[model samples]
Structures are given as C-alpha cells and as structure tokens.
Target: MLIGDVARRSGVSTRMLRHYDALGLVRPTGRTVGGYREYSAEDVRRIFHVESLRSLGLSLKQIARALEDPAFTPSELVSDLIRWTEDRLEREQELLGRLRTVDASAPTGWQDVLRIVELLQGLASTSAARRQQAVLAQAEGVPVPAELLAGAVLSESDPNVAGALRWALARAGGDGVAALTAGLRSEELDVRRRAVGALARMPEAPGAAAALADALGDPDPTVRRHAALALGGRGVTAAVPTLVAMVVEGSHDVDAAEVLGTLSQDPDTEDRITTALADELAAPTADSATRIRLTQALVELPGTTAQEVLRRLAHDEDRAVALVASAFLGLIREQPPEDGHDERP
Candidate 1:
C-alpha cells in the first residue's frame, strides 16, 4: 500500500504518516516506480499500532519507544497512561462543572461570565480567606448562583468560610435548597453536617424545613442534633424526640432546651415537649448530670406539667439535681402564669 492508501485505510492522515516516517516511528519498507513511499503489510500494521497508542494519550516520543524499544515493557507505561488519563479526566470534569455553573447563572454578557468565573475561582481557592471573600462578595451584588453557593458550602471545611457561604445561600433565597437537600444524602459525614448546618440557617427557605426534618434521622449524631435544633426552632414538633434526647445526652443540651422551650410556647406541643423531658428524667439510665440537664430543660417549658415536674424534681434523690430544680421552681412560682393558665404550684 502507498502512503495515500495506507492513510485512507488506517484513518491516519498522510501528513501524520510522513511525520511518523521523519521521526523514524514507522518507515515504509518499500518504494514504487516513481520512488514514492510505499508501505508493506507489516508497516501498515505498525501504523495502526501507533495510532492505537496515540488514542490512549501517549505522546509521539512515548509511542516511538513503545513500538521500537524491545527492552521497553508496557506494564509501567500502561500504568502511567492510566494515571495520566485519570488526571486529565478529573480536570475535564472540573472544567465541565464550572461551565455548567456559569451557564446556570445565565450571565448577561462577557463581563458577567468573567465575573462569575473569577468568583468561582475564588471559591475554589486553597486559601480560606479568599473563599470567604468570594462568598462575601455575593452580598455586594455579584448575583452568585445559589447552586454554586450550595456546592461551596457543602465542601467548605473552614468554619468562617462555611458561615459566609451559608449566609450567601440564605440571601439567595430558596433556590439553593435543592442542592443542599441533595447534600443531605451524601455518604460523607462532613458533607451531611455542612448541608444540615446550611439548611439550618435558611429556615425560611422553601423546603429547608423539610430537608432539616429529614436530617433529624441522620445516622450522624451531630447532623441529627443540628437538624433537630433547627426544626425545633421552626416549631416542628417532629424534633421533640431528638430534642429530648439532646437534653438527656447533654449534647448542645442548652440550645436544645431553648428550642424546646420555644416549641412548647404552642399549646398543642406544650404537653408533648414537657412529657418527653419528664420521661427522660424518669428513665433509669438518667445519671445525676443527665437528670440535672433534664431539670434545667424542663424549666424552659411553660404550662403546669413542667412546673409540677420541676416541683417533684426539687426533692429528687440527686442533691445537685434537687438544688437546681428547687431554684427553678422558686423562679417559676415568682413568674406569672402563661396565657391565663395558672403555673403556680
């Protein structure tokens, strides 16, 4: 086969075949009457082999060694190719993600695109300060896409940057809820925690409450606690059990108690919240410290049941718990009853 026939058959262009010949990668072993380059069957086969290796991201120099060097083993080279391809793929994926994010923002012009790209780069910067600055810039009229903020918030490890990202997401309104909701299902514990935390800050965001409610059942105790607290503050009674557990476990017990207090303000949840606390206090597993925390939590609740629970606790077995409960009971008595219900014991 001549060069043109070889190029046509092998899909390697004639110019590329000539370049290969120049580089001594694949030299045709025959000549025609006009002294034009001619390829033997084996030469054509070698051309196909070179093209095959090229498709695997091998440079021409590496291809030359692969084809001609008898001492060259492919195992290490193939491994290297695999790693290189993986790296390239990762870069391409990141670029594709950035492009998608920019597109989602619906930039009005080249300047908007440039600004969005710069902001994205800032968010992805290794420096936490840069990431924070990027997040804060959104508040200055950058019009950052919510999904971008949601993505940044999920991966941010820096507490300061994470807070800024959450604030930006909240400012962006409910649009970021979907991305944060998807983050709730992430297998990574930190991601789930971050997602719940961001969602917690956006209580008024549509679907944010439901996402937090779902997080209440998360396997991670931190995630569940955050979710429970957020939902409790939103007056979601579903957080009652977790809030009671928080008091019993002494994990964010004070904050949990406060939310429970707020939740109990509603007449419908007052009994349920107070009952959950009283039951935890009565549990045999309740230690002195746990009992004390529970007593303090009960003080945050309104209604006669909580007051009665506190009065009973004032004479409990644990001296420390009894002291705390007695003090709370005195305060409860001095205060007026809530909503015309007599809290006096």
Candidate 2:
C-alpha cells in the first residue's frame, strides 16, 4: 500500500505518518519508481501499532522507546502511565468541580465569574489567613454560593478559618445543609465533626435539624456532643439522651446541663430529662466525680423532681458530694418557685 492508502485505512493523517517516518518511529518499507513513500503490509502493521500505543496516552518518544528499545520493560512504563492518567483525572475532576461551583453561583457576567474563581482559589489557598479573608469577603456583598461555603467548612482545618467558614454557611442560611449533611457521612472523623459543627450553627431549618438529629448517633463522642447541644438548644428532645450522656461523661457538662435545663422547660420533656439524670446518678458505675457532675447538672433543671433528686443527694455517703448537693439545695430553697407552684415546704 502507498502512504495515501495507508493513511486512509489507518486513520493516521499523512502528515503524521511522515513525521513518524522522520522520527524513525514508522518508516516506509519500500519506494515506487516516482520515489514516493510506499508501505508494505508489515509497515502498515507497525503504523497500526503506533496508533494503538498513542491511544493509551503514550507520547511519541515513549512510543518509540516501547516499540524499538529491546531492553525496555513495559511494566514500569505502564505503571507510570497509570499514575499519570490518575493525576490527569484528578486535576480534571477538580476543574470540573470548580466549574460546577461557579455555574451554581449563577454569575450574571464575566466579572461575577472572575470573582467566584478568585474566591475559590483563595479558599483553597495554603495560607489560613487567605482562606479566612476569602470567607469574610462574602460579607462584603459577594454573595458566595452556600455550597462553596459548605465545601470549605468540611475541609478547613485551621480553627479560625473553620469558624469563619461555618459563620459564612450559617449566614447563607439553610441552603448549604445538604452539602454539610453529606459531610456528616464522610469517613474522615474530622470532616464529620466539622459537618455537625457547621450544621449546629445553621438556622433552625428542618434539614439542618434532621441532620443534627442524625449526628446524635455519630460514633465520635465529640460529634454527638456538639449535635446534642445544638439540638437541645433548639428544643429537640431527641438530644436528651446524648446530653445526659455528656453530663455523665463530663464532656462539656456545663453547656450540656444548660441545654438540658432549657429542654426541660417544655412540660412534656421535663420529666424525661429529670429521670435520665436521676437514673445516671443511681447507676452502679457512677463514681464520686461523675456523681458530683450529675448533681450539679440537676441544679439546672426546675420542678420538684430535680429538687427531690438534689435533696436525696444532700445526704449521700460521699462527704464531698453530700456537701455539694447540700449547697445546691440551699440555693434552690432561697430562690422563688416557678409559675406560682410553691416548693417552700
């Protein structure tokens, strides 16, 4: 076959076939009387081979080495190609994500697109200060898309930058709840913690609330505690068990107690919260320190049941716990009763 016929059949352009010949990658096996390049059957087969390697992302140089070098090993070269392809795929995925984020921002013009790109770059910057500035700049009327803030909130490690990102998400309202919710399911413990934290700061929306409710069962105690506090403050009685656990574990016990107290203000949940605390106190595993913390937590609650629990603790076997409980009872007695219900007997 002549070079034209070879090009036509192989789909390799004639110019490219000539370049391959110049590079000795694939040379014509013969020549016609007019001195035009002519390809034998074997030469055309080599041409097909070169095109096949090119399809595998092999550079012309690599293809040359692969086809001509007797000492060349394909294992290492194939492995390298795999790594290179993976890297290319990762970069393309990141670019695609950025483009999606920009499109989701619904930019009105080129300026909006530029600003969104700049902000995204800043968020991904290595400097925590730059990331923080990017987040704070949203307050200047840039109107950052909530999903962008949600993404930043999940990945941010620096405390200050993370706080700023959470704040941005909160101010953006509940739009980012779905993204943050996805973060809750991340295998990374830190990402799940950040997701719940950001969700805690979000407005009292059903999606945010539902996500928090789901987070209450997180394997990490920190995640569960944060979710419990946030949900407790929102009057979600579902957080009662975790909040009570926080009291027993002495993890953020004070905040947990305050939220429990607030939750107990609801007549329906008041007995449930008080009983949970009372049961922990009566648990055989309740050590002196745990008992004392539980006693202090009981003081945050209203109604006669908590007062009755405190009264029982006033005479406890542990001298320190007894004294602490006694002190709390004295304070409770000095205070007036709630809602005209007198406990002044």
By TM-score, the best candidate is 2
TM-score of each: 0.92, 0.95
Per residue, candidate 1 scores C-alpha lDDT tens digits across 152-261 of: 89999999999888888888889999999999999999999999999999888889988998898888999999989888888888998998898888899999999999
Best by lDDT: 2
Please state the error at residue 180 of candidate 2 in Å: 1.4
Candidate 2, residues 1-345, lDDT tens digits: the string is 888999889999999999999999999988999999999999989988999999999999999998989999989999999999999999999999999989988889999999899899899899999999987876466677898889888999999999988887877777889999999999999999999999888739549988899998889999999899998998888999999998899899999999999988876688898888888888999999999999999999877788888888899999998999999998887887667676675
Decoy 2 TM-score against native: 0.95
